[model samples]
Target: MPVLEIETIRGVQLMTMNRPKSLNSLNEELSSALIRAFHMASEDDEVRVVVLNGAGKGFCSGLDLTTVDSIGEQSSRFQALDEYGWVGRLALAISECDKPVIAAMNGIAAGAGLSLALAADMRYMAASARVTTGYIRRALSPDAGMSYFLPRLVGPNRAAKWLFTGQDIAAFEAEQAGLVDEVYADGEFMPHVLRIAYDIADQAPLALTYTKRLLHASFDTDLRSQLRQEFTSIKACFATEDVAEGMQAFSEKRKPIYRGR
Candidate 1:
């Protein structure tokens, strides 16, 4: 079976991590598959949003230990520089995709698995899901953007506490700490996620993409710069056919049908 399974629902593209026997762990093949999937979504004009989830028991259990051991055996000099290699670049690609990407965490996620989820613009978790930074347990520092992301997601102090101790956080705690956007029962995860994706896809694609881009830039920009970017994007949006439809709909007091132009 394919390591990554992709399907389209409306304008949303869903990518499922398939290695159920390993709890959907990240292997080189899976990583490469994910990279291709995200690139396709970004380039496909018909795709407006992307949702990532895992199959079977958990979202992801982390990187496959067998792969790690093999890499270690192959290299004469141990190096941290090769930590992500292609996989790390894939993570960045997912993060910067023009379309919004959402993570649907159905169960526990650790190590690189957790980092992959964190790369998404939004995350929805099952009530039973959990997440942890896995480096401390393996006698190493965090990888897969964990070092840069955690402190930003949770405050630096909390990030330090969790990273140093390798603390696993429950879904409820993650929501409270601002790591997740929402939580649904395990049985309702897919339904709620699909509802959200469809709703987002129904909007103008250019507007949604610009909003996503602006949100990402806001993470690193000051208020003045972000405001300028917002003005620029809004002006750009005004030039799209969808914006004209939106205005007409407002005048008619009816729902706007956006064509994503």
Candidate 2:
């Protein structure tokens, strides 16, 4: 069976990490499958948005430790680095994808799983879900872009505290800490997430992609450079057919039908 299950509803691609027996832990197969899935969504013009979640009681429990233990000490260190590098690529792909990615945290997300969630453009977590920087608990340091995404989302100090302690963060606290966008009741989580995804899909695709790029660039760019990018991007958006349709729709008092032009 495929380690990852993919389905599309409307223009939103839903990618589920499938490994319930292991709490959706990352092994080599699952990691590679996930990376490919995101890349596929990014390349597919029909896909306007991506939603990532897991199947089972937990979102993900982190790396499959069994895989690590099989390596000898001399080779384990190098193997570990290579494994994390692959995982990092997956996280980076999600961040850099053209389509906005939303993380639906249905349950516990820890270690690298937390890193994956943080990489998304937005996160909608279930009220019963929890998150943690689980590396410290296992005497491991952060990897899979956790060190990169966590600090950007929650600030350095709070990230430091969490990484240092490896403490479990409840869904409500995560939302308040800016680690999650919103916390929904468990029963309403998927519906709420899909609703937001559909809303985003309703906008001009080119505009949304440009906006996502600009937001990500803001972290590394100065105000002047950012303004220049915004000017260029907005001008490009104006040239798109969707913009014309949008303007016409407003004047006609009807909803715009974007063809992703």
Candidate 3:
């Protein structure tokens, strides 16, 4: 069986980590499979939204220590964290994906698993789901973009509190802290999240992509620069057929069917 299971529902692409016996842990094979999956999803015009989840009880338990790089050689160790490595590529593939990506946490996520979720555009958690920065427990610091994305998601103070003490954050607490977009009962979680993904899919694809791009760029740019980007983006949108369809739909008081053009 594949390490990652791929499925499609409407315009939403579901990528489920399948190492269930180990709680969907990220070994080299699983990590590489995820990188390829995200890239394929991004290139497929049919995929408007992506939902990442895990099989069985736990979402992902981070690295499979038995299959990772050894710590013996300091100079070349932790190659998974290098720019071209599997873990790094997977995180970038999610964050920089043209379409919006949502992390569907069906259960617990720790270490690099939580980092992957934090890299996504949005995250939806089951009531029973939990997440933690587990590196500290292993006598290590954050990896796989955890250090970068966490502070941006929850602010420096909150990020510090969690990172400093490797505590498992419950769904309720995560929602309250803005670490997750929404939380729902475990049994109905996927259905609820799918509805949201479909609603977003209903919008013009180009508009959604541009919106995500602008949002990501906003963090490192000035107000003037962001305004310029917005101006350029809207101008570009005006040239697309979807914008015309949207306008016509508004006039007719009906939903628009965008064709991505």
TM-score of each: 0.92, 0.94, 0.94
Model 2 TM-score, 2 decimals: 0.94
For candidate 2, list the clashing residue pairs, or say none.
none
Report the C-alpha lDDT of model 3 over 25-69, residue by residue, as the tens digit: 998788888888888887899999999999999899998888655
Q: Identify the runs in model 2 with alpha carbons over 4 angstroms from their true place.
A: 69-84
**Clashing pairs for predicted structure model 1, backbone only:** none
Over 1-261, each residue of candidate 2 has an lDDT whose tens digit, in order, gives 778999988899999999999989998789889988888888898899999999988888889888786433445566656654667788888888989999999999999998889899999899999999999999999988899888888999999999999999999999999999899999998999999999998888898889999999999989999999999999999989999999999999999999988
lDDT of each: 0.88, 0.90, 0.91
Q: Which ten residues in a row have the lowest lDDT in candidate 3?
A: 68-77
Error of 1 at 241 (Å): 0.3
Cα error of candidate 2 at position 178, Å: 0.9
